[model samples]
Target: MTQQHGKKIMIVTAPANGKRFCGETNYYEQLLTAVANSGGKGYVFPLDKNPMDRKGFYWDAPNRRWVAAFCPIPDIVYNRYPFKIRENKLACKRFFQWLDDQHIPCFNTAFFDKLTIATLLKNDAVLSAHAPLTEQLRSLEQLRRRLKKYPVVFLKDIHGAQGRGIWKVVRKGKSYQLHSQRKVFPSLTFPALSCLLQPVIKQRTLLIQQGIRSLKTADGVYDFRVLMMKEKKHWQCIGTGIRLAAHGGFTTHVKYGGKAASTNAALLRPPQAVVAFIGRHVGRLLDASYPHIREFSMDMVMDRNRQLWIVDINSKPMSFDENIIQQKRIRKLVNIFLKQGV
Candidate 1:
């Protein structure tokens, strides 16, 4: 559990203030403290700065503020920048390329495409049963065909997150009704599928997925958010929590009025052991395919028939809970950082 002394770890994330890294402030504070306690130095490296220059701001522990300094190429760079910034910016691409050129190890280097992951999982013999029916929405005709087979269908932006740009479509008599999460139009009734979806599909590539009949209580539909982190050479489950969607909400993202609590086995029809096993297997599969990934998050659910399904995979997972950080797994993660130095 020992780390190489004075090994530097730089956490790349979105700017919290105009000057300091504060997006996940509390979690970063705890992580920096954990790194210090483990004989390494942790710094908040902002994404806005030029990676090629090898100079950025670091948190000043004594002054309790950020100070600009000439940062050495970190032993490890943990990329936690928001998806939008990472996806759309030219500088981010250059920064990551710079990291590659420098041979610096970075985990969760980029975001995973929804359709690509789904297709890969569907093709895997062992994991195929756990994957939902997913297809890239290329045209209105494709959506129409899928709608005929499934009662409720979801059209999601391939790059969207936090429940943004997701639509729920339901059949209503001879027409169809669309319900959206973020758009100003709450509900729209369309006479034909093509008429409704042409405008949406024109905007961006969408993923058409058959909605799983979610397990629900009187409160709301619930699912699990399982976090897996690399422990030395192997992956380990660091945290599992139940997320209940807000009433009338289709997604369990916290930004959409969802709430999280410690996992309750009674809440699921299957034994918690089965769920954990599937989670571990999925994590291993993902890590094997994407070697640079040190941690990731999976969104999973159990249907009424007690079947498990993996709804989503996030390469850039959210910050870990303090309890998870304090566990023995953090030491293993730090050790990997010291050894890998990618």
Candidate 2:
């Protein structure tokens, strides 16, 4: 094990087999560059190749290729493993256990399930106030009973992301309507809710949540993506961006035709302080519940009444824009890694 620089930071992510770079490779490059610029070294590697007995494979930058080297175990690891890859492999489980045994600090330790997050928030006094009415749907009867409580509801897969596998159910007069990004099923006057959702649910557990009517513009509904990072042991809001749903879209997801723009000070209705409060509270809760989590990305929405609701908590959050990375938050994060000592 060799430490060329003061510290070695390893980014654990999925492998890009045949391509020049995967979708997440650019983000890893940015992270590595950041670490290098700050006088440290970084590399991206996949879990399968990371052996417990020896130094694993990592990207070699100067040579511009993947190379095998007996590099030192990283002083810090930032987990960016995609959920699909992590779920399908037992290697990922072992990798995390190895990290724990080695005492290597890693943030975004594991993927967060939507239902688990909702249940945790509901149990907290401060967080529950901002959490929507949510229930786990186990059967058709539960869905039918839940529909009677809210005029509009959202059926979400416990492990879904990128706006996929989500359905908006609206009660229209005597009938029900189901809306998705690409299609809409109108007048779902079925004998039972199971008839309509059984195929969609299909061996997956769903969460029935009261639909929130988020603020919208001419483009579509919008929400705030707040990036939070731990600075010297305390969580703080680093940057925020406004995500507008794409035309005719029901959810504001960047991949789902949603457009993200830097937050405009003039357009901030509830003030940045309020948003920070929400972010801080959620960050604290997550940090306390899940050890080794030093960062989070919170999808928050404000209704017409100016009340904030936390919609999603992303453990393995997407990389922020360059401007966000240039903020003091990133500097603090890097400093923490450097202080860990090689």
Candidate 3:
């Protein structure tokens, strides 16, 4: 093990058996493969897996714990851990802090401590034009009042994803109906919405947004998935794809019966100029507001009038499948990290 000049890289992932799927899996594997092809060693470690739990956990490849043990640290760590850390959720935070204490070069810092991704976006001024007005809905009257200003309003769980527990309301004659699953699911389920809202609002974290009419495709509604990666000088756009909802659907999440497709396809018809413009703005705002975060996946929609709206900004976005890997960009990222000694 003494005659090599390769780097040791690791990707942070969710619990091995965690129910949800994150972008880290494919990113780690593909990056590792790229590193190996580039004469470097790559590894992976589940963020929640404590090396101390199992006296000798056997990782076939290099792991974070082992890298910390044998090499004292790694050249770089691709942080993709998504679980929330609350006052009651501080288990793994200490471990990352320990690594920080040792001067480990983590892509993201735990300095904010227990703040959710939404917290970062809550302030409208961060990207005021891109962000919608999100208010804490108190009663049916408040929701009704909001309808006057915003014909379409969104009722979302503070902690929602993949379109679950997200409802859109539109005026229908004298009344309004909630839209999801491409059809109305009984107008408004106040009890259901309230149950989801109360707990978070009690913490003053729940929010309701004024909905924007997103671009629609022949298949259904669609949104842009812009991949932003941090380079030595600045954040660059690696690539972009369109997430199209299944036929007659409101959300483009594959889990909710949505499918992924190329942005250039007819089904996801978007102007190249618009896409490029959005990408540049997203990169600029991220560098200004969250400089500590190296990568993010931004979800945006274009209304009928062609105004762009940012609906989601995830610090950690899902990685593309092997079929769509952009090899040149991956190599550039590796070279940047190696050159900077990150």
Candidate 4:
């Protein structure tokens, strides 16, 4: 009983299991392992309703990997649902309800939809200064209109992450060229474009956005991942890493081979003001509405005109290769778990 005290932190996960993991059976083991290393207890909880204590998972230090061991009832729950598809399930909502019924505080229970995130930023006075025009994707006419105003337009899945479910469009004369899957499709007539996108629109909720060109720098395109965490009621910046987009890559996600640059030979880096704008100002605004969002990684890019735009905001951001930032983030989270625990 004493061992579990002040250390039990539970992570709510999906039923897809750790089998989906490419390497480790459970990915959250890294977090739990960090918790173990940080003098706190952490475990992964599957999204089912079973009440078995050891059914979840705990970090097994001796084995140097995750093992199914007895996990004591946690002091708090951290929803680390891996996929948007899984997190969107009704089971996730009900699981949160169960945690609520038990009076267990859970953080980061849901995904921030792109449309809502855009609207939130656009409506805020200070954040709006850096916001881009975003609208729901409905018709072919909408695409044409967006292109008229901006040289490029992007159709992003409202709930997509890691650069999946995205389409890039560039305007040329009266026609448009669609870019996706690392290949450029031939130019299409307005009518043909509508026909092509109709199925995609019906399948997923995509947001039409004005695309901002990255600043012309010899140091490759910089897509930044700004990690922020709450220290008491205020937010603190953990680190800003350059997400290295592959040459002509549509997205800068590691899954697509874009990793954080190892060297800082960059022609440009994010200004502290830009970091503050997202970490302090925008972080507070987001927290005010979504109080459950304890931490988030903001994906941002600076344009040629030196304007920064938020491309994505995620509650369960993927791992960064940078050790220092990861260390700071893990320690902060461990402290939060300890402080928030019963």
TM-score of each: 0.88, 0.88, 0.77, 0.90
lDDT per residue as tens, model 2, 102-177: 8877876778767778988999988898899887877776767777877788988877877877888888777888
Superior by lDDT: candidate 1 or candidate 4: 4
Worst 10 residues of 3 by lDDT: 51-60
Steric clashes per prediction: 2, 0, 0, 0
The residue-level lDDT of candidate 4 at 160 comes to 75
Put down candidate 3 lDDT per residue, 119-147, tens digits, no spaces: 44555354566667676666766776787
lDDT of each: 0.73, 0.73, 0.59, 0.74
Task: At residue 38, give the lDDT of candidate 3.
Answer: 62
How many backbone overlaps does candidate 4 show?
0
Error of 3 at 101 (Å): 0.9
Which candidate model has the greater lDDT, 3 or 4?
4
Candidate 2 clashes: the total is: 0
lDDT of 3 at 255: 75
Candidate 1 lDDT by residue in tens digits, 1-342:
224788988888765556465466766666666777767887776666565665556665666676677677777888778766364588788888887887877887778878879988998888899998988888776776777888778888987987777888876455576767654232345545566668889988889888899789787789877777766566677667677888877788788888775534357644657766776777777776776877777888888888888888888776544365345445656666666554
| lDDT-superior candidate, 1 or 2 | 1
